[model samples]
Target: MSTEKPRPTFQMDGHDVPFDEGQSILAAALAAGRYVPYLCYHPEFQPHGSCKVCTVKINGRTHASCTTPAHEGDVVESNVDELNDMRKGLVQFLFTEGNHFCPSCEASGNCTLQAVGYDLGMTSAHYSPLFPDRPLDASHPEVLLDFNRCILCELCVRASALVDKKSVFSLAGRGIQKHLVVNAESGKLADTELSVDDKAMSVCPVGVILRKRRGFQVPIGERKYDEHPIREVAVQKQKGE
Candidate 1:
């Protein structure tokens, strides 16, 4: 058997946090019960750094928490109100760009995007809707894609690449016209290896990607997001780590 030394632990925001060698700043903070707001981040997937929502002030400068590795004596502060507002504004921009009709959505109560909106106190979307008449693909028989609800977070695309071990989803087109494209040639999700068990379905923050059978399985009141703020959940998850 091979022997290897374990990574050291450090203090962050008054809590002892362990960093396993290449563990990220965000991962370390989560282990220490510090609530850092983020989107486009999943523990089981690779860090893409596409979404700047998780940016934090590290040593008096902002850094993408997901991409920054945890080191000894690093000062990470996540409680700044300005940072909070920035995240809120990012969420607002995402909301205005998409057709996030909470009351009519199947993933309304349990969606992380919705929870973020509530945390930001965004009662209504102020910007004009893009109203892109994108196609809804229910060809997979187990998943549905409502492109109008997409936020281009790349979670679904990354999940298919990293977690599911299949590069099924990709971003087609460019700029304001970019969108989640399924497989090659055919736009149908069923044509690819994307299964119901894929992480892409679970990683989508908005109702853009949804499960065909699992929608509304849990009542609105019983959903994990309905009872607590996203910050509380992040803190609890951090503590559990």
Candidate 2:
């Protein structure tokens, strides 16, 4: 007799969906072609659950979809009004927390933060911008670090240590004071073994970490987010990769 257990399924917006054991709600949803917006979740990296952008109503309770494990018959309410509004508020908070002036930002069209704001229909920051006088680091020959644009996502940190095998970045300080720091005695990225083509350089989802000589290279009308929205790009990236 054949011996194979039927795959478990969950109900995301009342639609049956299959998921592997221990798979997160966001993972399964993306695998099933249902895009749930997220920031701190990437296909190649472990879930950090920091952004809370993927918050969904799981079985009548709020949970971060990127880290919350999926189970059979779990009812996940992602597109509901309450959750979408909450995610929108989070997007606004992120906007105000950084100096994300999209008009002149190099990462404007391709940035996940700007893209997420677009996805959420965010027309304004809705609050005063912090406008903190953060420093910019062009110490590296082919890379730049603009602290003003950082949203503390830590994708660079994970890519540096986990993928590139170099501990180049970290989060230091508590709430309202947290910041991304370079791990070097000289507090400079040029002093590290960080190449321009390092995995960390490509993993940033914001304008903070950027490559030199490529600013506006793709042009505004033909950027990644310009063609396909972040939801589609993010979901396709997870499944296609």
Q: Pick the candidate with the highest TM-score.
A: 2
Writing each residue's lDDT as its tens digit, candidate 1 over 1-241 gives: 1258655765555566667778998887776677677878877777877777888877778888999998876777666778878888888878777777788788777788888778777776777867667778988878788887887778888888878988888898887778778885677888888887778767787788887877788877887777788878877866653
Question: Which predicted model would earn the best lDDT?
Answer: 2
Q: Where is the poorest 10-residue window by lDDT in model 1?
A: 1-10
Write down the TM-score of every candidate. Answer: 0.86, 0.95
Over 131-217, each residue of candidate 2 has an lDDT whose tens digit, in order, gives 887889889898889998888889999999998999899999999899999999998989898997689988888899888888888
- In candidate 2, the residue pairs with backbone N, CA or C atoms under 3 Å apart (3 or more residues apart, or in different chains) clash, namely none
Candidate 1 shows a clash count of: 0
